[model samples]
Target: MRVRELLNYFKPYGFETPDWMIVEEYGLRPDQIIRMDLNTSPYLPQKWLNSLGSRISKLRFNRYPDTTYRELVGEISRYTNVKPEKIIPTNGADEAIDVIVKALIDCGNEAIISSPTYDYFRVSVELQGGRVVSIPRKKNFADNVEGILSSINDKTRLIFLCSPNNPTGNTTSYDDVLNILDKASDVAVVVDEAYYEYCGETFIELTETYDNLIIVRTLSKAFGLAGARVGYIVASKGTIKMLNKTRPPNSLSLASIELAKIALRDYETVSRNVRKIVKERERVKELLSTLPRIYAYPSKANFILFELLEGDAKTLHKKLMEKGIVIRHIELNWVQRYLRVTISLPEHNDRFLKILEKILKEKT
Candidate 1:
């Protein structure tokens, strides 16, 4: 089968191919599975489910969604304290990334990204024919702000920053983000806050001060609406208007729009779940630290990243799966020693730790 050459760029993601097979071989039905690999919310609000059921039965399926999704935009506006005209919702935050890259990036132009961050930023930029200039983070998993500043040049068109960065579980400093914006005045800066609810630190306020700043958020993470695939970008009204030109009309489904509205309405439930996850995250860290060979990093997100001091992470991951416990194993050369596990329900968390302890004791 002939495929687009761009597919070659994704070869480094070794998990993409074998991940499904692992699930199948282990009889890991989604419902039966203890899924700590994806960092998904364990609880979906009852309100969203009830609303979706009623909307499906009452809404017109034959007709297309509102071309602009203006009402949904208004809800997001009120939620974020940004004007409706300044927000644009896409199929998901992933699509929002594609839209921004297409709108602002040109062939041979460059986008700056901090290394060992989310892999999608590099994928999207390369797919759009832009050069990816990586600035490696400090050993402590913080952005190398000085290195990023030095990398910007005339061809630099965009910069992607992932806060509480995926897998790493740490946040970028607000002052550092402001400094980058101050120096890279000519480039567009995208702050991806997919885990915003967990950290509660954001640069959405900076949109008022800098026209080049853009913030991307998704309902998939903290809101437990990943299946709805709703995500949005916040920017100045002018930038949003430009993004709309590239966005396909009626890109979101009627059901997704309705569910997002319902999710927003029940913000209290979401907040409660966030508190549970935060509390459980700290407990998970404490337990993992006491295990014989694990060194867990401090986190602001719903997941923890750790390293095995005496054994290979890949081996540990395989051993866990044999017992039906699943977590992410970081096998890339840069982060090869690390394994990331989501902060799941208390019982699930306890089960994982118990199994991990057994494995370490056997090795010793």
Candidate 2:
């Protein structure tokens, strides 16, 4: 028998796994390809880039990183306005999801998820041999708060929600999350604010009032540090203490921790970039609306989700790929015919719109 029979494994989460070789695959130079699939910042702040040299010395790579991650926690505390003891530094938001699952989920138990928000939350719960009770969102990808509450039962151990959800580019109402928090007693509720900087609203303030609330965030989006892989969890001190045990020692590299600290030092730069991205996102939505048979949905994050009202999204995705432009083609039942594109630099955005117009014109 195969070893697969003795153990369980599933394929990893599927986002546009960036292939650098896409440059040669499409017969384009490195600079010609526009990576709009991942909602990462198109421009890395020069201030942060310049500080990487001096900051490199701060990490003691010769030795293992501090298990407690004291310095990183201190920096994060100042940045996020959360106390040091209440924070747990993670390798990425992905790690925080897994750690929370491991901490709360027992084998054969259940976790509640608002569907199509973030896939990894489902993956994390399933990997622990727990059942995922997926409550589908309504049209335009809005959450059904009552459905979520009714789904929670005695076996329910965790509930996960993502604000400014991935792939769909919409923020769940904060009041709905508060409603869940008030109702779901004895169950851990995780509100992932990974795109918090883009939207500028948070449930972090409620962490003090609710003991079971967990807020996870990452530096990958607006901070322009996706490559560094740094994220953190903000919860009450006791909850943080429990998660600390589940986390492996020195899980975050010294370089990553130091680089994150440097990146956080300049909020003004981050804010300026966020403003530009929001502006460009609106411009893209406006342009998409002007196109024949396309509907651009309102977005709070740095990406815009639009539907091809008449054509196949997969076909359009391939056409854009031919032009060396990459974006997310979401094929979920709720978002059928939908596509999501990151708000990129001005020239990249212009190029995408120009080619898209040509493709639709050809189809007509």
Candidate 3:
């Protein structure tokens, strides 16, 4: 289909939102709802909140930020151990994806992505009037590297790899990434490391070796800065220069940049929080496993994806909602009967486990 024709039928990606109507029907306040759907950090301690709020007043909200975002780039460069010239600060990882798509994709061009992964990659590509070539992941939710590599042709301009993939909560293998990089030498390989802090494995160093590699990172996940919307792209100097052309000027707010700087400076604190989440994730996974009907998949990310063996996923989702809890019931064409819940504070985790166990038991 032509780009203009496709625009008429285009469906913008809709982000998940809590069912406020359900919340009202249950007679519960918004604050009372235990949010385990979004893969964001649990409530921050007061000290962390204070730290994030400390310098907001100093930032000139009335004035435009440095369009180049030089200071933020320097901080990100220091944090990621990449040179400053190779980094481009973005509003969020989503924007980073959009910028990459904008720079590389033209009408009728193509971008390859693995199925049951983040939808934004597909959206970004399609928005640029580029076609999305989706390759299904392996049975275990690993990227079908061979399929992806084979699908690449002259028209393929971008390949998005979301490590520690969302909803599925799995990482792409290092060797598999290298294999693709070796094969698709001409195509831009975009490695999204949004969840890198959860799992220490990374393809960042590969960027130095392969000029076609673009590594996208964000403070959203482990750093608990989702609202701040700060992410950066790491690529070769030439690639960064090209992406900068399409990146929106002053896309990041001064407040976000300041918060990101604070986040990078307080790496120790973020690390501590990440460790706690990882520990909690294991505990939650074990607890979920005890439920005979739910098969929780192994995950390195902050969330768990599981299949409902007996009960209807939508029913379970509704039950959880009535009980003032929220988690994602994943609905996609290639996958079914799956749900995901973010790992949260121990008490919150315990509540969800207790409620879920009760619901599944009653179903039996």
Candidate 4:
């Protein structure tokens, strides 16, 4: 295929309508639209924002950030309880994925993915000219450990797993992860814990035991830093060294680094917001289950995956969009009826539920 044709095959992240388009077409102001598609925190880290605002005046925009990122690494070390040498920060978990794939995946190598999870991992691997073998998850959205292991071969170089997984909001079993690690000892197994703050389960501890294990996490979700784009990788020091060679120098801006440090300093606030979001998640999930013909999957993370039993997901998504409420419509072969919604503030959640119920009732 030509370069343009190959580019057409590339799948980028998320579906979005520009703010200006929404305003012009939907006749809704940007603030009126409730964004439930992107799994971002509705609540801001007010204290961190306040601190960041005060510190922004002190930042030197003209000078570049320290490429070594020692100070930021120290903060992350304290936060993650991992040594600084074992951590390499990236622009976001997305960049961490790209950098790791770039470092470890060469042309013609294969990477195995647990399907119906995040799409970016496959994109990263393919960009490196690596082939992707996707093993579908079980009916319950759990990893198919046997299928994944059987597919591993001399060409397999990486395996990607997401915990409290995107869209599904379910976690991979710890034993399943351990089994994959033991069997595929030569290939790198990257576990993405981007929603860790919501679930509070981690495989970071296993990194000490397994050299091939890599953990990528982001502050974009729970830390309320999506726009700032801060994330990091946790692996053995040797693995970190190899990834560092491919990681771009000064990928994170000075403002982002400083804001992340401030956010880390006030970890208590992040935890408090997490608790609120988790509580709201349960409340929202319960309410969603009460809706007729809708099944809301049990979620450990801050978002919930909902399956519509009767209606078309695309039609429902369009209806929600017309009403200025946006949630993701799952497009996988096995889950065409599924839609994922991020847990927002209580009022916003109530609004979404009300609007959604009305839409379903109207269809009936």
TM-score winner: 4
In angstroms, give how far residue 277 of model 4 lies from its true place: 0.6
RMSD of each: 2.0, 1.8, 2.2, 1.6
Pick out the ten consecutive residues of candidate 2 with the lowest summed lDDT. Answer: 3-12
Residue 68 displacement in candidate 3 (angstroms):
1.7
Q: Model 4 clash tally?
A: 0
For candidate 1, the lDDT comes to 0.88
lDDT (tens digit, per residue) of candidate 4 on 30-104: 888988888999867677778889999999999999998999999999999999999998999999999999998
lDDT values, one for every candidate: 0.88, 0.86, 0.88, 0.91
Pairs of residues at least 3 apart in sequence or in different chains that clash in candidate 1: none
lDDT of 2 by residue, 31-142 (tens): 6778899889987877676787777876578999888889889989999988899999899999999889999998889998878777898778877878889898887688
Our tally of clashes for model 3 stands at 0
Kindly give the stretch of ten consecutive residues in candidate 4 with the minimal lDDT sum: 1-10
- Of 3 and 4, the candidate ahead on TM-score is 4
Model 3: runs farther than 4 Å from truth? Answer: 1-5, 18-22, 48-54
Preferred candidate (lDDT higher): 2 or 3:
3
**So what's the TM-score on candidate 4?**
0.96
lDDT of 1 at 137: 84
Comparing 1 and 3 on lDDT, the stronger one? 3
lDDT of 2 at 91: 91
Give the number of the best model, judged by lDDT. Answer: 4
